[model samples]
Target: MGSFYVTTPIYYVNAEPHLGHAYTTIVGDALTRWHRLLGDDVTYLTGTDEHGLKIRQAADAAGTTPQEFCDRIAPAFQRAWERLDIANDDFIRTTEPRHHAAVRELLQRCYDAGDIELDTYSGKYCVACEEYYTDDELLDDGLCPIHKRPVDHFEEENYFFRLSRFQDRLLDWYAAHPGAIVPEFRANEALGLIRGGLRDFSVSRTSLDWGIPLPWDSDHVAYVWFDALTNYLSAVGFGDPAQDHTQRWPVDYHLIGKDIIRHHCVYWPAMLMSAGVELPKGWAVGGWLLVDGEKMAKSTGNVVNPLDLVDTVGVDGFRYYVLADTTYGSDGDFSYDGLVARYNADLANNLGNLMARVATVVAKKCDGVGPAPRADSPLADAAAAAVAGATTGWDAVSPSRALEATWGLIRATNAHLEANEPWKADPGAEVDAVMGDALEALRIIAVLTHPAVPGTAAQIWERLGMTGALDDQRIPDAVSWGGYPGGTDIVKGDPLFPRIAS
Candidate 1:
């Protein structure tokens, strides 16, 4: 069995889970689900980044201890995932004992390599971001680019990582491994940062009391990136070198937002090199989901609560929009009008309409029993083309493209049914052949679309009288154009997607 590992950025628990957090987790969930359908051994990991200065400040305002605050907010993430049907294999929190052990081991390895050293630093800091910014990075009013608020000046004694020393090594690595950073444009951005000159980054903070203490020195705690990034390895048993992280480590991919491409594509690779570990196979950078041409933010009160959408549109409906609307690397705008439009067009019209029409025809014309498809059906050719297109899109980690390709097959199947009009014909070999071809197309669609809209896909599978877990079906092969064995009972069930008023 081939093994694959993928992760979402561990979300900071200072706020409740938002659509942005849900977006990455759902993408990871969809990719892992796709891999599983291909018969690969997959590990999907996501969790909360509980230990950080931001969390400490939020806890103070709430009149609670940091741990207590985290304990309360962490469940929001887990519950959200559950509600969204996210199939993550593990949820690792930085506060977990296993995670703490792994972080210390990783820090010690880098420390012994002379990559970490004590230093004094002063800069404009954003408490919300838990990061310092240079004057050039700050706005005219000394505000953080992301938060758009005045940053505070802070000075402290801290341990720094010698990131500047590895600039040449990082460039060399990127040279040998092209396309390591996605979209080609993001790769150029990373190269620009490296050529501009790398700066040594502080890895520990003296003023924060809510983070993991430095293993050798308890006076300070590990900074946000160091503590948070370690969750990827720590979740898979990387802390204990003797443990078999070989099954999951040297991760196949790290899915992150485009804003953090530098950290994941640049600083992260350098940190791994300093620890004498192999780098991740790839970095899949995604653009932000904007609302009204602005990035979603809590302070601005523009954050879209994912649950609100889930309540309005079902879980699968929300999942479908996120995966189908955005090109993986390009920024996407989110609007209620857009969601409802997609739900009506793709779900209520295309997929749901196709399923309902086929089942209704089978019930009326074929005594509620599906017949076998003809040997030379045109629907077979369309299914083959759709499968190929979707497989290529998934390989590139573009969920939107994959869904688009899959929907092409769906629309084609609907067109084929329209050309034949099986409902208008008598119950005979001709009607059986046409309806049979449509049923076969539905089967392939159920398997191919299982990753994006799992609940709805399974419903289609059962409506066709198929057995076994829909998720266990392998891709390309499961959708191999002519796999539906006919002469099975078909049921005209309730509408898969009820139309929602705009």
Candidate 2:
């Protein structure tokens, strides 16, 4: 098996976790899970960005130290991921000593290469975004475009990365790797930024006291961009020789929102080049989850608490809707009515109904013992087609498409059952063949859809009386037709997904 590493941009601790945060994290979790099913060793890393100007200010507002403030808020993200069944391999915090070491190493390497030099700057900065904005990039009122607030003027002596020198190198790298960024449009955007101009960005801030100190210069601390982005490396032992860094050095996918394209696609790679580090293999940039035609933000007063929706539909239902409703690279409008409608339509009426009908028919027609499926079962071709389509969709990082392909098999099997009328047939070879084929189809569906809905898939596996942990089942081999040997007792338990009231 090959190694696969994926990451979600670490969430800032300045605010509590919201639906926007949950969507990115869930997508990472699902992507890593898919890799695991393919028999690959996967590392899914996500955590909190605990050090920034915003964090220092937030601590003062809370009447506590920055560390205490982070300690209180960081666990909220961990708990939210747990509630959503996010199976991340590592949860990193910027405050961790390991992360500090990695940032220092990267900084020293860039400094040694003459890519970092002392500089002074004065500009309008957004406390919310912890970024500087040019006059042309700001609103007509000279406010931060992202937060729509007055920008604070800051002048400081800091160390800057010589990003200007890497312009040609960055362009050449992108030209060599055509698909380095998913959704080809984003790759073009990164190329455009390089083509426009590259400026030396500050790597260390003299004003921030709550950050990792530079290795060569103790008076300055690593800036937010440098410190926050190093978590991807620190979690994988970038500076620690005791761990095998080469195994997963270059991440397979760096999943991020469209808003941070410049930082990830542009700044990150240039930083890596200066440090003599390998660049990430691919970047999957997703658009914002908008609410009422506006991005969800505290300033906008439209942030969605994912937990509240979880309380409505169960965890799996919530996970399925978000993945199925949003095409990964495009904006998705979030609405409560839309969520309930998707749950009732796809889960309760379609998949859930199919499960109940099959188990009940097996109990009555085949004496509750699932029979072995026919090698040439009517559903075999459909199952093979579904597998191909699902694999293609997942490979392209399109969860909506992958799930649509999976449900194709589910829908097809339901139609097959309806046409045959297995329930009406007497308990004979005819009924056995139909029921057995349905069970086989269910087995394949369980394996294929396990990544998106792990708990629910496990439940389906259990009710099928399948032996062994579902997670241990590998793709291709496990999903091949006729893998379900059947002859085990079937349980027609409660509905897997009960209908949600309109």
- The runs of at least 3 residues in candidate 2 whose Cα sits more than 4 Å from the true structure, single-residue gaps closed, are none
In terms of lDDT, model 2 sits at: 0.92
Question: TM per model?
Answer: 0.98, 0.99
Model 1 regions more than 4 Å off? none
RMSD of each: 1.1, 1.0
Worst 10 residues of 1 by lDDT: 474-483
Tens-place lDDT per residue, model 1, 1-502, is: 4888999999989999999999999999998999999888999999999998788888999999999999999999999999999999999998998899988988999999999999999999998888889999998888999899989999999999999999999999999999877767878888898989999999999888888899999999999999989899899898776687767888888999988877888788999999988898888889999999888889889999999999988999999999999998889999999999999999999999999999999989988999887768888888888788888888888999889999998999999988988878888989988888899999999998899999999999999998888987876678876778887889778998888888
Candidate 2 per-residue lDDT over residues 332-370, each given as its tens digit: 999999999999998998889998999999999888999
C-alpha RMSD in Å of predicted model 1 compared with the true structure: 1.1
* lDDT scores of the candidates, listed in order: 0.90, 0.92
The candidate 2 region of ten consecutive residues with least summed lDDT is 238-247
Clashing residue pairs in all predictions, respectively, total: 0, 0
